[model samples]
Target: MPSNPTLLDDQPATGAPPSSPSATTIGDLEAGLDRLQSQGPPARRDLVRSLLPVAAVVALLCVWQILSWAGLKRSDLLPGPLTVAASLADAFADGTLQRAVATSLLRGVSGFAIAILIATPLALLLAQVRTLRAALGPLVSGLQVLPSVAWVPAAIIWFGLTDATVYFVVLMGATPSIVNGLLSGIDQIPPQYRSVGTVLGATRLQHTLLITLPAALPAYLGGLKQGWAFSWRSLMAAEIIAVGGSIGFGLGSMLQQGRDLSSMPLVMAAILAILVVGIVIELLVFSPLERRLLRRRGLLTQGAS
Candidate 1:
């Protein structure tokens, strides 16, 4: 046969060789594969990390059950998970749990809103004025370290065992955190961003709203989250200790009643409910908001050096 016309010699192999793809096609396939592989690790890691915490909680519950079974602790003093679960079901059936949750959530949200409204302007003022910052910064930072319960005494004195007292305590507990957060966020903003704003002839208000506020959102959000935590804690403390008719039947009051009655199961149920509510608020609202803001600005993954 006439030298068996070589495969490579036949029309330059039309497109790709029989055993190999074109360089561009190979590159595209490699890129796709790399993307797929890259995506797989994060998904697997997230699943594993999520499962690990749940596993640990389950293990702790098992240990608790074992302790109860072994008679290492009195059932009344250290009720097992089953007892607490039963109490939760009973409370739900009686509608007490719903009312308590609603009461606590209302207080938390109201106090948090007031704190944000007050703190935002104060923070802006402090950030822009060195004298104001000097006058207020230390106080704000100091307030962060103070326990929310400490405000209960002063709040009661000023507001006299009313819902206003509880609100006052909550505001005191939360405002410092919000102010400090905004102040620090402003401080941390890059000077270069400010310079760009100045170069663009941005007004003071425009610079703050468009440049500083957006850039410092992460820190501000951080403060808001912490402030909410403080507000919740303060409200609970006030409700539990103040013992006034105006406070209503919040989870904190229920917890206090449980303690007075020596009802371990009820106490446990109240505590669990509080924890669950905090987690739900964070997960449902703040977490998604924070993620959206950070992702939109491409700041979530930006590392500080």
Candidate 2:
């Protein structure tokens, strides 16, 4: 509970529009959100901690090699790590890997950007409008859990082997995530913050943008990360299902080609390329952003590993 709490009842009688929320009240709301936060950042990770992921990858490779030697499947069907590595090297030297990665990344980023543009205002409108929220809230929430690949048939039917088809799938997968995240942030805000904003005579827009929105930052960040994941997954699915010579080949296309050729090494390399791209973005982009946000808000106490 807040000390010297401000509630609707505590506000002085007013006639004009509410003013902006006080900085103190905003600060208090931030603190309250922290209290309600169910998760916290893990302990500080350093050089050794970073190496853990590399070590895990090495261990998995060893296991894969052992499985190959144990003859779980014919060598032709299940290539060893060295074979896959060689295939990856060949793709890299020929520039196929680079082009495939670039194409896939472009699609994923474009879709995610479009999703943010659509979702931001949609979420804000829904958050503020009681009737709209009541009607569509559950539907929107459900959309986040719906598999991105399920949209492929409809997208293909409508847009037909074009970039538009791929974009539609990405939009379907990512928008729910971004909207839900923003709404969740808005919901997590303490009512007292609104009361204080009212007492200060802030307009609805001002209160929402300045108070509710800023207070919702942590939740918004999580949603943004999920949106990226959804977009990436959707893009790969679209690329696989909507393969066209007109549309430049992507990483997923590489995988399909490998399958068609019955080359396990190429297939494994393509799979790893997809996984590595996602991991790289998460590690280099989202993780750093998250850590910075937590640290800036005085919510994280990271010690050197």
lDDT of each: 0.85, 0.89
lDDT of 1 by residue, 189-280 (tens): 99999999999999999999999998888999999999998998888898899886566788998899899999999999999999889888
Candidate number achieving the greatest lDDT relative to the actual structure? 2
What's the TM-score of every candidate structure?
A: 0.82, 0.82
Write the residue-wise lDDT of candidate 2 on 1-305 in tens digits. 22344644555556443366668878988999988985765555687877887999999999999999999998989989988999999999999999999999998998899999999899999998999999999999999989989999998888888889889999999999999999999999889988999999999889988898888888998999999999999988888888883678899899989988989899999999999999999989988888888877777666622
Indicate the worst ten consecutive residues by lDDT in candidate 2.
1-10
Stretches > 4 Å off in candidate 2: 1-45, 301-305
lDDT of 2 at 37: 86
Supply the TM-score for candidate 2: 0.82
Count of backbone collisions in candidate 1 = 0
Name the weakest run of 10 consecutive residues (lDDT summed) in model 1: 39-48
